[model samples]
Target chain A: MKAIEIDNLSKSYNKGKVQALSSVSFEVERGELFGLIGPDGAGKTTLFRLLTTLLSPDAGRATVDGYDIVKEYHAIRSRVGYMPGRFSLYPDLSVEENLQFFAALFGVNVEESYDLIAPIYKQIEPFRTRRAGKLSGGMKQKLALSCALIHRPSILFLDEPTTGVDAVSRSEFWDMLAGLKERGITILVSTPYMDEASRCDRIALCNEGRILGIDTPHDIVRGFDNRLYGISAKNMFTLLERARAMEGVVECYPFGQRHHLVADDSFSVEQFTRQLSDIEGLEIASAEPTIEDMFIKLMKR
Target chain B: MNSEIVISVRELTKRFGDFTAVDRISFDVHRGEIFGFLGANGAGKTTAMRMLCGLSYPTAGSGSVAGFDVMREGEKIKRHIGYMSQRFSLYNDLTVWENMRLFAGIYGLNRRETEERASALLKRLNFEAERDTLVGSLPLGWKQKLSFAIATIHRPEVVFLDEPTGGVDPVTRRQFWELIYEAASEGTTIFVTTHYMDEAEYCSRVSIMVDGEVRALDTPARLKQQFAAESMDEVFRTLARGAQRGE
Candidate 1:
């Protein structure tokens, strides 16, 4: 059975001045890791809020584990876990207290659900006595995840869980999420970082409150139709402008120190090299398309 | 390229009672160079930046920024440097032009100069239409761009960006880096801290802090080579896997 389903979901704020979600629809299969990938203000948070029953959608319908979102919110609430983008745990409370409080609210004891949260909780267990406010960003996120899982929900919604975290912490967080998926939990995560999208089982590319595309990370990158070339020179800024103005160049944008240039059918590496031969320290080579490149192309389309 | 050292530090230390937030860290930032400060959460990166920016006093050791002593010349240091934090620091209620005018005033620019510079900056950023719009209403990317512009309005010798690209998209991030590059090209030294490993590759040199100490410091290529890693992310993981803090 599907873990969750949405049909014609729509929402607006500021008296319809902002169309937060525009008739969005998608499905997450049972035990799948689903990712909502987009930039900020792309309706990611609104969609999560709607699924978690925190906000009512203006139109359309959605169901969590076969329960209608609006009419059966109470029942849905007990079956799912949610970690908001912003840190929401009580600052004055110690890490242990926050976990206990969340467990009690769910009518469960920490010992009763200890096994479910052990992998994540163990990382922050050493700092259990520390106040939630004093914990670091990565530790705070781990604590929040543990609290959310203390009740052993079958489904989890994490909104930008790895944002503003160091590279090491981010990889560790993903490893924890993957472990959770192994226990047959349906997970829905949202992030602005394109690299994280590859870690998900499937991703929905969102923009301006709409899903631009939905597919596996590999499939999304494979969908890019243009030949891309990575080009660089002594002065990268000048190289970007020059490449953008060149003929047969469809799109050009900086990716790290190099510029990624998309070419048309008439484009050739030889012609491109000859065009900028005067430039010193020039380097050009064919490059593979990444998820970020695909997202930019989709947004432009 | 200016080989002059814009920021120099030696054995910089900061302590809160018995807790050592920063312990004997030292580094140098060169003029027109992008220096990245990286670390795990609660790894003393912020504490060290606070000391260098003169926002917090060191418990021991010494440092200098913009040729002024960090110990007794914080005011002089502030006047020669720009800083943009993770949070947008502009007044939300103020219009774009108003915020620009306010910052220009804070930087001691004359009324006529403020008006001219603000207009020119808005035009250059293609934000002329947002001149009268409240800064709160603009998108996150625009707000960040404007914040960077505001931070450097006085043309300080060096600019400190503390995770300035947090929550922004890849496209916008690339554009933001263009601004950083532009500033650096004009001889404005950039000392930045970021959590994004990919961003670390863009820096001329990077320092990774762990548990109040410098664990690794080198160019992105050299660090990756030294660690036998493919990317900065791997290098960081290899080093930070032994982090003493945050368990």
Candidate 2:
């Protein structure tokens, strides 16, 4: 059976003034690692809430682990773990106390769930006596993940779990998730960072309350139809403007310290170089499209 | 390039009893440069920034911002600098124009000057249509950009951005960096803290703090070469591997 199945899901807020999600459809196979990639206000959080049974959808249907989201919310809730984008742990309680509290809510003891959380819990175990509020950003996230996994759910829903942590912590967090996936837990995560999308088995690129594209990260980049080139100069701002004004330039935007330019059929590297020869310190080369490039193109479309 | 040193520190230290949140860190930030401060969540980055921004007193060591001693001239440093964070400090209940006027007033701008600057800023950001709209209704990216503009409204010599691009989209992030570059070009020093490694690459220099100490500091390219890594992400991992805070 599929881990998750959604057909034409729709939701809105403020008496329909804001359409948070509009007829979205997607499915996740059992034991698959899926990602919901998008920017803020793209309805990623709404979708997570709906799937986790915290909020009801306005239209359509979804099933988590063969349990209907609305009618069988109790079953769905028992079978899935959720970590909200914002930190929700009690500040006054110690790290250990928070974990014990969450486990108790699920009618389970920390000892019974210790094996599932061992890899993560061990890291924060040294600070078990410290107040949850006193823990650092990375430590807090690790603690939160431990709480989520205490019940050993069949699937996990993590909403932007690495949004504010440092690069090392982010890498470590993903590693933990990958380890959990190895034990056969289906995972669905959402993030605004495009680079994180590549870490998932498959991802749905979302924007403006809609799913623009859904595929593996490799397949998504492979789908870009235009030839891309990386161009740089002494003055990036000037280079961006000039590249945008050039003929046969389909799209151009700043990427890091360089400008990523997409070209039309008539474009050639030599011709482009000759066109901008007057500008000093110019360098251009062919480049591969990243998830960010594809997202920009999809948004424009 | 003979750039002026806007900020300098020597063995900066902050201690809360025995915790030692910031441990003798040292660095320098030059005028018209984007200096990135990176660290693990509890690695003492916030503590260090607090000392430099004059929000908290250091237990030991010394530092100066905008040529003013951090120990005795915090108020002066505050006046010469602007700050923006992930959670912007704008009044959401107020209109865009009202927010601008309020901030300008706080910075001691006269009424006529406030109106002129607010109008010009709105036009420059293509936000004229939304001047009367409530800040709460604007998109996240738009609101962040507006917060940045307001932070620099006084035209301070330096600005501190605390994860300013958090949760923003890639396209909007690039746009935000354009604003950063524009400000730097006009001689505003940019001191930023971020978790995004790619963003670190855009900085003129970056310092990685691990366990309340600066583990590495250099330009992105030089750091990458020194660490023998392909990207900033790997370089960060190599430096932060020995951290004691997070297992």
Candidate 3:
């Protein structure tokens, strides 16, 4: 049996005015690192709440570790660790106190799970006496992960762990997740960052509560069939407008220093260059499609 | 390339007791330039921005924003620039039209000018139909776009965006940049901060803060080459990795 199984799970709020999740379904293999990649309001959190049994789905059924989410809520809650999008540790409690509290709540002591959380906890161990709220963002993240793992959950659900964090700290958080994954924990994480999609074994590109596509980051890029090019000029704004106006150009988007222009086979580079010959310092090159490119393409469709 | 300098700082410093939050940062942002101000969390990017925005008084150094002296003309400086952030930029309960009118009024725009600007902005955003809709009801992407329009409504000489695209979707994030480019082309000097390295590359020039200092400042192309990194992310990582602070 799969570590997780969902069949057409649906959820909504405000008497169906919101429709937070719409018939979402996916599976997770045991000890696999799966990612839910999407921006805010993409229902990533809704799905997490449903699987964690915090809220019953409006329709459909799901199971974690062969246990029905609704019927086996107790089993699921005890076996799964969740780090919400927001920092949720007690502000008044010291780092060590919070860990001890969580462990005791689960009928275990800190020493029982010290081996499971030591890798993450040791970094913040020096601050054991500091209030959880007083720690820095990076240290706070480590503490939250440590508290979540104090019970040694078989599966982990991290919702937007890297949101609002700097790139350096985000990379560090992912490294911690990787370490946790190696301990044979089934991990399901969500992020709004397209760049972090590459770190996941498989990702579901979600938007507006719908899964656009689900595949390995490599396979998703390989699935992009359009001929995309990176085009830049002295005036990037004008370049974007001109690229969009040209016939056969499907989409033109500003990507970092240059614009990623998607074109059909009918488009010819020679003709494109000839058309924009008047534009100065123009540079064009075939570009590789990234996860962001694929996510945008899939979301549009 | 010699555009007029709109924002100039020299040895600008901000301190709280013994801790120096912004330490001797110096840079000049030219007119109509999109200048990216980047740094890790708790690296003093906020303190420096607060000083430039005339919100917090600096401990030492000299600077001017939109030609207003930072030490003396803080209120005058605030009047000449616009500011927006992902959070707290808009009121949830207010309708789009109401929000626009509120900001326009706060900026001291006359009644006629406010109406004209509102109509033009609504048209540009294709949001005329939603004028009466509550801002809280709009999607995250739409709210951000609307916030940008409102921030620039006064047509200030400079506008500062604080991570305006954080948590926004990919498609809408690009759309936000187009709005930024349009504003810059209209001769508005944009001072922005972001964690997205790709967005950093969108700037005409970028200044990265490390330990309260302007550690790296250059065009994205030059910075990448100087750091021997392939992407802005790599360059940022190289500079930020050496920081002594832990956030």
Candidate that would win on TM-score: 3
Model 1 chain B: lowest-lDDT 10 consecutive positions: B238-247
For candidate 1, lDDT tens digit of each residue in B136-220?
9888899999999999988889999999998787778889998998889889999999877788878888999989999999988
Segments of candidate 2 deviating more than 4 angstroms: none
**Candidate 1 collision pairs:** none
Best by DockQ: 3
Give RMSD to native, each candidate.
1.6, 1.8, 1.0
lDDT tens per residue, model 2, A1-301 = 8999999999999999999999999999999999999999899999999999999999999999999999999999989999999999999999999999999999999999899899999988999999999987778888999999999999999999988767777777899999999999999999888888888999999998999999999999998999999898877667887888888899888776568999999888888889899888999989999999999999888
Per-residue alpha-carbon lDDT of model 3 for A1-301, expressed as tens digits? 8999999999999999999999988899999999999999999999999999999999999999889999889999889899998899999999999999999888889998999899999999998999998999888888888888888899899999999899999998899889988999999999999999989999999998888889999998998999999999998988999889998899999999889999998999999999999999999999999999998898888
TM-scores for every candidate against the unseen true structure: 0.96, 0.96, 0.99
lDDT of 1 at B206: 91
Supply the TM-score of chain A against the true chain A for every candidate structure. 0.98, 0.98, 0.99
Residue-level lDDT tens digits of model 3 in B8-122: 9999999999999999999999999999999989899999999999998889999999999998899998898999986957999999999999999999999999999999999
Better of 2 and 3 by DockQ: 3
Instruction: Give the distance in Å from residue B74's predicted Cα in candidate 2 to where it truly belongs.
Output: 0.7
lDDT of each: 0.90, 0.90, 0.92
